[model samples]
Target: MATIKVGVPSEGDTLDSPVADRFGRAPKFIVVEVDTDTGEIVSYQAVDNPGYTAGSGAGVKAAQKLGELGVKVYAGPTPGPNAYAALNYLGIKVVTVTGVSVREAVKAALKELGS
Candidate 1:
């Protein structure tokens, strides 16, 4: 099976970092590779959020970046309309996760993926 890559908007590089409330405006994104069979986090890395500095169409730009990163799932607060549409067009799944930390959000996403 294909590895499930989940993206969480975050303020820092580690899972212990807090989750960002706004998707496009987030400072960074933590991309985690989760094992579908065991629901274990295999790896993770932080990517700079380009949209954080964009004057407009930030959501669209961010969504395109995530698509290029091969992110199959998004775990965070609701995104803006443009971003949402971009994600849908790219066939990326969005999951709502409420948590203080990125780790919590990732856990919630893994659970939702039934992994």
Candidate 2:
């Protein structure tokens, strides 16, 4: 079945984790695979952000990590300019979403991506 993976930068490591205030330095990324045809969540993972403690270029590192993780769309606060450029180059669609849990953010991302 067709599916889309949406990622949300989060403060914690769970579906209920709150959305992180910052994207590049978020501690974790909650990624969910949702079936495009049914909109049912197929699977999910909470990946530790490799760029969380980077001294510099954190946004670019985070973008690279997300791309490596196969995140088709991102749901969180806007990233920095460098990160934005990287994400755009990777063709990872981004949608602004905050004040919500990871699960909620995934839903929003799917909607924003029209999946």
Error of 1 at 59 (Å): 0.7
Q: Scored by CA lDDT, what does every candidate get?
A: 0.89, 0.90
Q: Return the TM-score for candidate 1, rounded to 2 decimals.
A: 0.94
- Model 2, CA-based lDDT: 0.90
Count of clashing residue pairs in every prediction: 0, 0
RMSD of each: 1.5, 1.2
Q: Residue pairs in steric clash, candidate 1?
A: none
